[model samples]
Target: MSVRAQLFAASLSALSLLTATGALAQQGGLDPAKLGLNANENLRALAGSSNTAMVFDNRYEGIKGTPYAIPRWLPAKLALTSNIPVASVLLKYDVYKQRLLIRDPSRPDSLLLDANKVTGFALTDPSAPDVATGQPRVRQFRRFAEAPVATQKAEFVEVLYEGKYSLLRRYAKEMEKADYKGAYSTDQRFDELTDKSIYYLRSPEGAVAPVKLNLKALQAAAPSLAPALKAEGSKRPLKTAEDAASLLRAAEGQ
Candidate 1:
């Protein structure tokens, strides 16, 4: 095999080991007893629930940097028809190959969106108390992804927010019912439930196969994983799915 191929194999091996260690730690499944009891149980609990099956074929892209800049090709294809303030849009494209490469912070790139291009839109509230003055607080509805020319891949509409639970619920509900007419033909693939669970599995050649666990296990491990979680908090320490993925990627790299 070529040197490139060997590196690929090594990365896969590391990924496999990371997954295996995670699975072994979750052998007993999501145990409430393991995580300290707290009133936030509804948010933290993930035991004895229906096994939510996920299609692993989903792709992801890493959108990093302070001022975000999405590729015109992919972002133009995402359908943002929901009439709600988008909290955060989660795209699952392959980040390794398609990281939205950050430009010079002093001279960041910008993509303009025409009225016809977006399905919906919103602007940040200027009247809102200045949490971080001088930081650009404008919010806009941008595209996320599109279906292949032949395949019927669904476009996900993620709502961005910066408020408490009531505000979250209000916007989430509006997004759940918004009419999404994107590259994808149907809404069957769209998920509206804000509190759904998902999981992933990993394997490496000639290595021990590992079991699988979902977000529940991570939540179960949160209280105990406080130290790790706290130390890594600055680098997106487990608030969002993308943050959690970053944490896992960092751990796997080590």
Candidate 2:
């Protein structure tokens, strides 16, 4: 095969794998207990009794609006609590509204899972590319809710790095509006959807505290490892969450 043909074949193979994974997740044949759930707990009971599904309306008035985040339907395992059975379903995270949307097997429409009820969740997608390495990435997100602290509210934060001192990423979204003037008239409308990735540090004492994505913030969070982190940052540019994770791992001597 030619070089272009080889590349196209590889792309097709990757797409096929992703499609199969999504189909399996949506069809719901996977055992919940095997997915890290308590075997004795009732799976159907934990899924709740609600039949109403939340629909995402992308049309504002008559105009089509863009989604706040890339719409990804992935296989996910959700835990309500240790006592309740973990539910395995196809879920989508709405970064715009900070909501977990689920397509229940019994429901025709997508339903919003209660954020407060969710203890944690894991999403797996095989189609994404790794940020650090330019290879095909099986993206996995493991997030858990922490108790509200004085500085931050209780919300699901993704575990970026876990050690004596851990790094977490929190996602928040806000709507921006502006006045759009047409040829005939003007009207106020949503200009864009803005999202923020806020990083936090979990101390060895198990307290969670917010930290900015900067070397100074990392140093402040771990005063003992300040000099080491600064050295690491000097070696390589610390510009993203992945860079921060690399720094943390180095500082911890992992």
Candidate 3:
């Protein structure tokens, strides 16, 4: 056979191997090592295994409603700190499940990083508009390893006001029955999205405690700033997370 024909046959065989093993299906076209995941060597190994459950799949087409934190998907940077070198990667966060997802160009399937493996992350999206003042809402989050609130598992908590006394917000999402039924069937089986938020206070004494959403409870939590909080509450009651954050800032003399 001619040399050119032999070369062509070898190329075809290599392509067939890649296709059968699914090696050419990676997304994002980046290596996990570049994403600061040396410690997760096991996870990378599992990606190549025949067992499919190890791979993270984001295509949920069932009755599950939207699973994103924001109405729109915003580009953000994720930071992870571990025995491996600290690395930052462009990723997305699903606020509903509180999971970090990434789409690697090298793989056709996306991967979900274990929350426990992440130290913290930040969103680069422009500040959201506040519901009350129509101003941009600026918030940052950190992994609260020892959160005293009902969210027993340590996760990201928004830092509302940071000072001698700090206020934080924990967001949660759940699914509920939709008010309207599916158009195709009479069975009222459709599901709707619902969210829940809880606020907490971290005092100088190192106590992280949950604060109720009422004026009375706010006052009880911070007796020293009761008067100031009450004054702010009179102007704008603590009916929303932004309101609570604003009140905390006022108490801090910001």
Best by lDDT: 2
The order of the candidates by TM-score, greatest first, is: 2, 3, 1
Predicted candidate 3 versus true structure: per-residue lDDT over 138-166, tens digit per residue: 34667875676457556687777777778
Which runs of model 1 end up more than 4 angstroms from their true locations? 1-116, 119-122, 134-136, 144-228, 231-254
Give the whole-model CA lDDT for all candidates, comma-separated: 0.34, 0.69, 0.66
Ranked by TM-score, the better of candidates 1 and 3 is 3
User: What TM-score does candidate 2 get on C-alpha atoms?
Assistant: 0.58
Kindly list the per-residue Cα lDDT of model 1 for residues 1-254, writing each as its tens digit: 99999878866865665566557558956454533233244333323256667666332222222222222222122334454443332222212222222222345463333334345333343433333465434444332223221221121223232211000101111113323347764533343323222222211221111112323443344334445534555565355534454454443442
Model 2, 1-254: lDDT tens per residue? 89999877866865665566556666987664443343222344344477778897453544234442336677787767554876588887676566788886777899888876776676665676566676654333444345355333545667778888988877666656655556654565546656665778988887777888889999999887898898888887788887888889888888
Candidate 1 to truth, TM = 0.20
Query: How close is every model to the real structure, measured as TM-score?
Result: 0.20, 0.58, 0.57
Candidate 1 lDDT (Cα, 0 to 1): 0.34
Per candidate, the number of residue pairs that clash is 13, 0, 13
